[model samples]
Target: MISKKMADAINKHMNLELHSAHLYLSMSSCANALGLKGAATWFSVQYREEMAHFFKFYTYLIDQGENIELLAGKAVPNQYKTLLEMVEKTLVHEQLITKCINDLSEQAVKEKDHATQIFLQWFVTEQIEEENNDRDLIAKLKMVGDNGYGILMIDAEMGQRVFTPPPGTTVMI
Candidate 1:
């Protein structure tokens, strides 16, 4: 049985994941406002991915016999001054998520909760990919440096991403 503290912590992470989905959805709106349809599409895909992640953990809580609650999220961020700035902000956010996952992993081990530790391993590795991808975008954005042609090229590339989780692969949280 998981401790109440562990359950609450998982719940909090689940809420944060949902909040992140909303945050990305808001970002997609901003991209639409700026008329970057391809970028908006990419953000939309990301938004959906975040929602899946949220549900994965939430369902895990339910499976484990924990009471679920709907938590309020902070307002969608609207502070980036430019598209590149927004991408940079995204990279930073992903890094923060990686840190949170690492902290949770450490806590699970310290509590002798092997199940959580196993569940967290997936997120830990996922974070690596997430951070690397964002950082790579930042690097490429810098190289392109507001060039319309480059941005469009990237926008086209991002548009190709489709949400297709593997069959029967649930978030074993």
Candidate 2:
């Protein structure tokens, strides 16, 4: 069993995950509106992955015999000044999420919840990959600045990204 404090923290994190998905969905819409179909696809795939993350936390809480509380999500903006701006914002948002996960892990450790610590390890690793991807894209965007052809090339590359769930994990898209 997890401590009440830990459970509450996890629940709040779950809400944040949902909000992340919403933010990505908004980004997808903005990309589509800007006629960047490939970028739109990328953001949509991210939206799905975030939803899968939310469910992971939700299932874990349920397995711990905790009552789930549904929280209302705040509004997500569907406009961006430029593709670079959108990606930069995404990187910043991901950094915030990484911090949140770290806080959760710290709480788990303080409470002496070994199970929770183990559970959070996956997220810790995921945040690494997530930040790395954003940084890589930022580098690419910086190289492609003001070049429509370069932007299209990056968009095509992002379009090829598919939602591949971890082995033995069933993620609903």
Candidate 3:
């Protein structure tokens, strides 16, 4: 059985994941409004991934026989000065999420919930990749600076990104 503390934390985290998805979707809308298809595509993909993360937690809680308590949603800004600004914000947000995941891992250990600990291992590793990707995008955005050509090039490259669900995972359409 899942401990109350662990269950509460996971439930809260799941809601946060939903917030993350909303944030990303807003960013995608901003990109689309600015006619940056590539940036929009990238943010859309991130939005979908965030939704997947939410479902993962949701499923885990249900499978463990825990009641899910979804918290209230939070508002996120829908405007960005530029793609660079958007990516920078995303990196900062990702860093915050990484810290949150680490805290949850610590909680799992403190509660001696081996199952939760094992489950969180995936998220711990995922954060590393998440931060790395954000950093890489930040670097590219920095290099381009205010150059229109560079921005378009980056956008074109990002436009080719397609969402591919992880093996054995089913994503809602």
Most accurate candidate by TM-score: 2
Candidate 2's C-alpha lDDT?
0.91
Tens digits of per-residue lDDT for model 1, 1-173: 77888888888888888888888788888877877787788788878877777777777788789999888789888544556776787888888777878888888998999988987787887788878877887788788887988987777777787776522236622
Q: How do the predictions measure up, each by TM-score?
A: 0.92, 0.97, 0.96
Clashing pairs in 1: none
Better of 2 and 3 by lDDT: 2
Q: What are the lDDT figures for the candidates, one per model? A: 0.78, 0.91, 0.89
Give the per-residue lDDT of model 3 (tens digit) for 109-173: 99999999998898898889888988888899899889999999999988888887643245574
Quote the lDDT for 125 in model 2. 94
Off by over 4 Å in 2: 167-171
| 10 residues in a row with least lDDT, candidate 1 | 164-173
Looking at model 1, residue 138 earns an lDDT score of 78
